[model samples]
Target: MGDTPTTIWPLDDARPGEVVVIARWSPSAGKSETIAALLPELIQQSRAESGCLGYQAYRPDGADNGDLVLVERYADQSALDAHRNSVHFRTLVLERIVPLLADRHAVVTTVQ
Candidate 1:
């Protein structure tokens, strides 16, 4: 499969045919480890999705942290939506991660 060009929204500025999603997560007090253990599988699954160009998970640099930042890119809106509605999203993200999270925020942007 051909790779789609990817760029950081704040840097390269997004363009059409690209969809960017930024997700910030704050795991519940004392639950960072639990959440951390689960993210690898989730990230792997997400990166394997069709139209996915990039999927990265980040946390604070210095120490074991309670926060996570997810940066994702898809070929288009439909791909992002498909990801949102995927079973993993419903079961793992919504059911599991959502409860462990103290708060979560997501923002979507289109490059163009």
Candidate 2:
């Protein structure tokens, strides 16, 4: 398997401290297992990071589409940036996740 290209998007006019990353994958070749396998590690890493307040992953109810949502809160933009650069995040995304996703989209957003 090889690394697949992933897109990262910053959500609608969000401020500096909070973020929500939405991930979408192809339906027939879903990424549920991959996300499940990686989520624990990702959560742990996020929690341990300097700026992470909370991080969670979810699958929308009644939705057959291969979509996953990650809700993340940080102390500030610096924390979120730190998460992006963290070893765990890098490893999870590049080594574990990229190979499994047929298509991926990430949107970073903040709460009002």
Candidate 3:
């Protein structure tokens, strides 16, 4: 029997795959639901974008509502940037959705 050699891919090799963005949007008093209502369109439009791996919007269950959390995954930096510059993002999210928020925070990272 012949022996086979093992192959190892570097950790950084996986980094070229995608970028993840985690964000929280806390709308002003009485506006969370309004913003929440708009999320479906935002998510749908974003999903239709090129290089969009995953995009989601989440809100508190029941009456303990607080902030809206959005988790987004893109194929790379260029894809993420494209999403940000898209008409949907520019109009729906940046112009309309953002104004409803009292606070917003996000973190972006590269992922496999």
Candidate 4:
């Protein structure tokens, strides 16, 4: 009998797959508007990526929690990696937005 190797979708050797990332960002006091203002440019730049399937951001309804939710889809892990390495992500997100955020949370999943 031949032995079959076990493999994980993303952690193992998967290629040309689908990935989804959901992120929540809570802005620091008085910084919600600043983050909101930057979202348009962020969306524009992100959507222009070759491997980006979808990019959307939302503000929770009822009361101002100053939290922004982002749902992003990519063609594969490489695409997601590219997104994180992009100039806009580095400058706008890591540099500008991260400093203004009180907290941030994210989850990454691969489509089966």
Best of the candidates, TM-score: 4
Q: Sort by TM-score, best first.
A: 4, 1, 3, 2
| Candidate 3: pairs in clash | none
In candidate 2, the residue pairs with backbone N, CA or C atoms under 3 Å apart (3 or more residues apart, or in different chains) clash, namely: 11-108
Report the lDDT tens digits of candidate 4 across residue range 1-112: 0013342222233234689888899999999999989888998899899998878787656638789888888888999999999999999999999999999999998877
lDDT of 2 by residue, 78-101 (tens): 777888888887888777877776
The C-alpha lDDT values of all candidates are 0.80, 0.64, 0.77, 0.82
Best by lDDT: 4
The sequence of per-residue lDDT tens digits that candidate 1 reaches over residues 1-112 is 1123363333254457799988889888999888888888888888899977788777745535578888888989999999999988788898988999888999988877
User: What is the number of backbone collisions in each predicted candidate, taken in the order shown?
Assistant: 5, 1, 0, 0
**Candidate 2 displacement at residue 112 in angstroms:** 5.4
Q: Which ten residues in a row have the lowest lDDT in candidate 1?
A: 1-10
Q: Which stretches of candidate 4 lie over 4 Å from their true place?
A: 1-16
Candidate 3 residue-wise lDDT, 38-104, digit = tens? 7888888998998887786665345355687677888889999999999999999889988988899
Backbone clash tally (model 1): 5
Q: Candidates 1 and 4: which is better by TM-score?
A: 4
Candidate 3, run of 10 with poorest lDDT: 1-10
- Cα distance off (Å), candidate 2, residue 21: 3.8
Model 2: per-residue Cα lDDT at residue 97: 78
